[model samples]
Target: MGRLNTLDDWLNYQENLHFQDINLGLERVKKVYQRLFPKGVSFKVISVAGTNGKGSTVAFIGSIYQQSNFKVAQFSSPHILKYNERFVINSVQATDEQICHAFEKIESFRGETSLTYFEFSTLAALIIFELEKVDIAVLEVGLGGRLDSVNMVDNDVSVITNIDIDHVDYLGNTRELIGLEKAGIMRKNTPCICADTNPPASISQYAHQIKAQLEFVREKYASDIGLIGKHQQQNAATAMLAVQKLNKILPVNTIQIKAGIKYAQLDARFQIKTINNKTVILDVAHNAAAVKVLSAELAKQQCSTIAIFSALKDKNISLMINEISMIINQWLLVPLDVNRAINMKALSNEFNLNHNIHVCNDMQNAINRALNDKQYQRVVIFGSFHVVADALKILIPFMKNNEEEIL
Candidate 1:
């Protein structure tokens, strides 16, 4: 295999790699990984799996560990702004050239074995982490934990953020079934942290079955986060307890944990930014559980709220709409340009919100119309990552222009 010089070439090669199906099977990918990188079992890895808050939890763990001066490697999925954001070292995104180089190595090593796009990327990340001699690596599971490619490695700490009904088709319909799938990341005698306040019985049962030290959020450690939303408190608490347990073995200091938890800035989770003297909040609340949290946060704010929403077809759009209906004065439904995107017409028909809702096919137009409206004091951009990504592109430029004019 030839080396990849440009980002586009690497991405193109990845696109042409084996197809991806969201399921809980790892035999083929694991065999390829074992043949290519047999030494991966020696690395220190932390696997995080949950329906929501996995990214934020990974960020918090990485930030705290990095603050303590440990060489840390972090891998996450479904990047918002850049592909490089998925892999980070010491709190900085890996350069495009670095990522391409890693991919090139993986491509050559695999030989006759075909790897899926995600499996190839995960292997590349592991290779980079090993080469860097990272003291610790945090991996966010792309789907259910048991058979997910990331679970191929033995993790020192397995973190489950919260269970919800996002991927019902793959996992299961109820929370217990989903919890069982996620609990697969836990290894024998390893410390597993459950961030969910009310975790499913299956998760606890599996932890006991494996003899893993299970730590529940409210039961293990309590936290008070400066960030808004009740759900964030649970995330923070889970992170704090995980770090506390990690501190017993690793050299993570309490001061670093406090500092990291206080200053962690995950881009799209209740993110508030002031643009042109107006407040804009961006949250990636595409599921029913997340929308319920966002609704609570909206109730606490003393401003007229206008929600810019979009979601994928697989999601429970009707339930999400029903949750946010009373809280938002106007609904700006924008269509995402993706195969799984839910069209505005389908959403409108399902919810019967014609009076307060306005359909805009273009995301930029929806954001501009919402931002320009003087009636609403606060504008919230929530839904899928696609919607939030489009809004960020527009909002960043608009805010920058306004700042430049003032200067």
Candidate 2:
């Protein structure tokens, strides 16, 4: 409306323009892509798809490429703080003016077609990457890879970080079914790296059928990473494998790879901070698999910890809670400010039998409750990105020291 000027205005317009929030088909986006760039992107493409570690892998790759003196552009999803976080160029986020300009261009290109919110963002990021003439572009799939908007751009190297039972409604219920959906990103004769220790047979089967060069992380990278948890080594190794596949063209040395993994930083991935004299760990572990990883890391803390948790309506809240029930001494549940967030009543029902549960008024109240309790040595904020974002808005202002997350 009225030539939307602000980034917020364009975001609002995109949200209402589409009938469904997640329209997972590439045709609509591909049409718009053709109109925007008929010749296609010139930069090398690395598309990463999976349930959990897609963002981390993208970060590691971008960091490694950046360390090698190559101009890198990374496109990711579901920004924690702002929409600009979705489009990053050379470690810097796209500005509001740039985003507004990209949206206006998209609005002009799509004459009669409809694009979903995520599709619009994907096109915008690609347009920016092309305009800036980035050397390489790393894209994280927003959902299932087969029909996801990001798949419109053919990747030079495709990566499936790890597959698990996630997005069951859209992808499928079983890992085999889900694996096929993610395998859609792999192209014939192209290098495809799957970082899952034990991947589904469907993944290798699909690769065999398509003749995609499928490689698994049989050996983990024996190096220390800046991020905490042993699982990060797998993600870093996956990124390394992708980098090695493109070594002839990209040419990143061992020193650069090690430096990149050690310097890479992504927020809300078992991120540690000291706020108001209390230790808080923020993780976006919405699914059961990710929650299991978080639980393992929490176990190593070996201190009394309480969790402030809430998840989306579609998530298996019971399984996620069970993963860390033994590690977390108390639970502070809070509702998120999103349409998909589970309500207080339903969330309370998940922890009904637990004796130490606190249904806080909001995220801030939950943090306060956890900090005031002297019994807990640590406060963990986990569930969805929405929950962690809400905590950051309140906790960032009071953060006194940023703790190094080392295992």
Candidate 3:
């Protein structure tokens, strides 16, 4: 293959290079990783694994470390806007030149191994982080913890952020079975934080068998987190408890924790934007668990909601729709271009009884309807992350109206 110059070229190469999209295992990636990085990482590693709150927990942890003057590198999956969003060095996304350089180096060493798009991108990010010699590396597990490429490095601190029933295909259907998979990232004698106060018994048994020190979330930090919604408070508490275990190495005061939780901003979580002078919220809540939290938050909103939504075919659509029906006054169902997206007719079956349900061919048309329509009090974009990513383009002209989220 010729040397790739643009970021698009690198992404296209990665997409085409893999035979399968999600090949879950460590040996193939670990073997190539070793060749790319002969000398292992010396920085403190914090690996976060969970069903819903993994991204928020990582954002909180990374922001706190950054505020405390520690050089931090974060590896998160599923970029919302751009591929560079997956790799953050010192709180900033890496430039195209930087990512291309990392890709070039990894390609030079990866001779025989065939890596998936995610695995290859993960290796490239790690190579950059190793070269930067960051003080702390915060890695968010892509899928199941045990076989995830991110789990190849032994983490100093491991956190499981309240596992639910998401990703049933790969991690098993039951919570107990899934908890065991998430617990695979825990190293022997290292501190393991279970953000879920009521995690399955298998997690406890596994941690005990591995001799990993485990801390269950309790009254340790019950105070409200900086973000809105009760679920966010729980996520903040989870990150707070996990950080306490690392206080000796990376000391941060209560003030910093307060600031860090307040400053921790993600792309789609309770993100508010004013589109054409009308307020709208963007939340990526596809699963039943996350939708439940979103519905609870919606109840607190002062006005009626008009939601522009799209969900993947694999999601539990019935539960999500039923949960939101309690608070949503109107629905603007849209279709996404992704392979997994569900069409409007398919989505109609779930909310068939609702009188106010409407449909549009695409996200932009839905946004257009939401902005022009006057019946609903506020517009909410929810369901899958892809819907919110596409909706951002429509809201770009009104970027100044976006509240709390950065550009």
Candidate 4:
């Protein structure tokens, strides 16, 4: 880590920079951000926050702007594949040299102030966006919005996809509390759209308190979407509403809006692929809410399915398992090596009563066993981004010659 010359070196150094993995406050980030850009970012920003659908919404908005011939920079969290995936401008990931340079600059300006790994990543994204002089930047909140490093910037618009019971430790257990945390992205007098049909009162209360132009959009987009699941329609509607609110500044026509929503696709969100004569579906349904949606979509497939799953200890594992238990025929429990991942023995015990559960040696073993099982025609890799990332690492190269298609 001598000079942090490479992106990997900088990323590794940042991971050990802060005492905590998620120090959810903006003070340190703001101090460094001010140093990076005293006048703040010149491009328009639309910050998205929610338990789920944040990535999809960001994709929709970014795709719309890109389709409309505008330079769009998108910053998302917890990349499934690589760190570069977190920062995309015009659908291309930021180069290693560019990201490393940004990291070096942030480190120089950071001085004695300590910043979390996410904070450094957020700062780097903003710096890259400013340097690229992008027309707009769509930022996905890493965690709870109020104190999240991304919240330091005053965004032009805010979108809350839906509030659910996740991140209980930090955001609180109730939807009201979580909704309020998600509501923090809203700025005074700026448009904030809540796509949740029945949003918690805390969201409106906070919005009203700040005099934000909060619009509760209950209607789903009435059109076909490239991404599967009924939830995508709602996300599409939310993205559309946000775009409409910015009409005066970033005007996009109906055709562009429709096309963007239709074509917007994110990795591991109900993503489908055909590999080795078997169908594989990958989804990052780590929480119960997302798993519920994944279950509903899974029910449509007539073939018997086997799931390759693992999740973090903090997540509601029982609820997530139960949500999709009915759709998945057999379970291949794979262990993730991450610090927060649940213990394999404990996870296997959760499926004690389920006779179809098979503890695999590793992700590759799980993939092999699932694909080799003749009884199961479909393989589903779901749970956390970690699981999907592992699956992708093995599947991407295997899929090079195979025809892959997204749902």
Candidate 5:
């Protein structure tokens, strides 16, 4: 085990540390974490879990608390552009040196024990957050909450944003089963908020069984959050309500709440832009449920949409297509560069000539096809995070950096 001085070196080393891609248990990671950090620091921990809105809920919580003069450490997954984006402190992404130092420390402690990619990265985030002594840490669950590496931390406040059918192989196919998995984050007597109106019975049942104080986000805010769509309103209300419940731990005011709502925004979740004199909406909506939200959002604009889409094979593509079919005038589908990339022939067979769908081998060619024969006012790039991420390669280079909008 040689020294991993650079961030890239550490990343590459961790990528192959485990034989498999996803090792869904926490026993090995927990042993290594305990060995590394024997004495956990004092900081309020907020853990959020759900199928679709986990990231937004996390962004909302981080934004609101930071506005109230608290230094926040937020750990999220699946970095769109860079690995550094996964761990953020005080809204500033971790520098390569800082991440490398954390990774090196973890590696030193985890000599014999092998950790998965997500588990290693999560430990690094925890180490950096504790080393930096942030006031609060918000953790977004990487997968099923129970065995997910992040469940090792006892959350002061547990948030279950919404339960949907996702990760069926790992978390079960039914919503009730998935809800039980998400409810694993709840702690005894801790405040647990379920922002979903029709939450699964397993969530409430498990909360009751554990004697955790559970509450639905009863208050809905009518005011606009800096982001788009009505779905954001629910997430904002959940964040504000959660903060209010945490007054005993970290008190906040209405002024801070308003300011937080004014500034809270996350990239690739309904992010809109103008590229080549055309309105381009970039969304990481791979699931059918999220596609429904994307469709409803598209309804806000009367103009037809030309979409550049690609998704993993496991997703319910037929349902997703049906959900967004009304808004999309044409579909420019491309193959993703992932191990689980869907077979092109199987995907193409889902639609016929009347669907106005065109196939491309890669993202660049798909973009060229979309631009050459522009049939609509708006171009939507959705279906998966890979779609938006690949599109960013073309967008960020040619288009003037819109830090204010994109960031």
Candidate 6:
């Protein structure tokens, strides 16, 4: 079979998958994955899962492994910019041809077993990792872990980032319930790392049930990261501890860990940039828990904040709004152009806080409004990934133009 040539072709193929809901049973996907790549797989895999921080943790580990002179492949979900961002080999994104070829191979091998878009993509990434002969492969679970296709691979080390109360419909409404779903990635006798300060009881219970050696932050190890917020420091510390334990299992050295910690780059996580003499910070804080962190970060900054916000329909909009309402001098609500996006009217009514909230259907208009306001020193573009992605697309060009003018 020939490979997909264009973006539209790849998208059309993905749309044909026909799997919509979050299926928690892995029998079908497991069958396909096993048939495609037999058990006792080729590459060493590290599976990371949680409500948040999974992508950053995977990036940190992949960076460390690459710095250690090991060929590393990382597969993450919900790309911020491009589809190719999902698969990175040796710190570089896989070429479109590489992804298309892997997808073609998966389509041929997946005979009769129906796979979700995420599942198919996971299989393709694994195929690419195997073909590349990577020394380490870090996979981030797209959703709750047990049924997530990435969990099909027995991980060398399982890292569960901080669990929260998002995805209530599929993962349950409680923190403990969600944590159990996330902990499903842990394997027997493998080292499991949990970054949550007050981890749900089910997480520890599940780790013990699986016979995985549990490593908890502030208990087994600790570190003080120079990151702004407490949550980021906790995430950095958890990743560092995981690397420490992984070093014992793998051939990683201290120098590699140090270099990885120093150079990990993840955009749109409280990222600050100056464009046209205006300070703009972009963060993807879609849920209440994440918004709490954003609230604190904004409080720490030294200027009046003008917020450019958008969120998904499923998010706790009221809770998130309430968390940051006090600090927001002005609110520009932009609608995200995705099915999962929340309507601006619904979000505006949900907020109802005593603040000046303006709805801008166009993202650029919202950004322009925020930047044009010379009164507010800090402009925060936040809420959903779509909102941040759109904002970045505009901001990057604006910044580039300003830089050219200066030169």
Q: Which model scores highest in TM-score?
A: 4
In model 4, how large is the Cα lDDT of residue 3? Answer: 70
Tens-place lDDT digits, model 2, residues 192-261: 9999888999999999999999999888777878777789899999999999999998899999999999
TM-score, each model? 0.93, 0.97, 0.95, 0.98, 0.96, 0.94
* Candidate 5 lDDT, 252-307, residue by residue in tens: 89889888887887998889777666788889998999999999989987886788
lDDT of 4 by residue, 1-407 (tens): 38766787888898898899988877888999999899999999999999899999999998888779788999998998889999999899999998998988898899999999899899999989999999999999999899999999999999999999998999999999999999999999999988988899999999999999999887889986877888888999999999999889889999999998888878888888988788999898889999999999888867798999999999888888888888888899999989899988989877747648988889999998887888888999999999999999988877897866743
CA lDDT of every candidate: 0.81, 0.90, 0.84, 0.90, 0.86, 0.81
Candidate 1 residue 39 C-alpha distance from true site, Å: 2.6
State the displacement of the C-alpha of residue 194, model 2, in Å, after optimal TM-score superposition. 0.4
| Candidate closer to the true structure by TM-score (higher is better), 2 or 3 | 2
- Looking at model 6, residue 343 earns an lDDT score of 82
Show model 3 residue runs off by greater than 4 Å.
Answer: 220-224, 401-407
| lDDT (10s digit) by residue, model 1, range 19-100 | 6534357887787678667776555678999998897888788777877877888899878878888888887888887788
Q: What's model 2's overall lDDT?
A: 0.90
Q: How well does model 5 score by local distance difference test?
A: 0.86
Model 2 residue 341 CA deviation (Å) reads 0.7
Q: Which ten residues in a row have the lowest lDDT in candidate 6?
A: 219-228
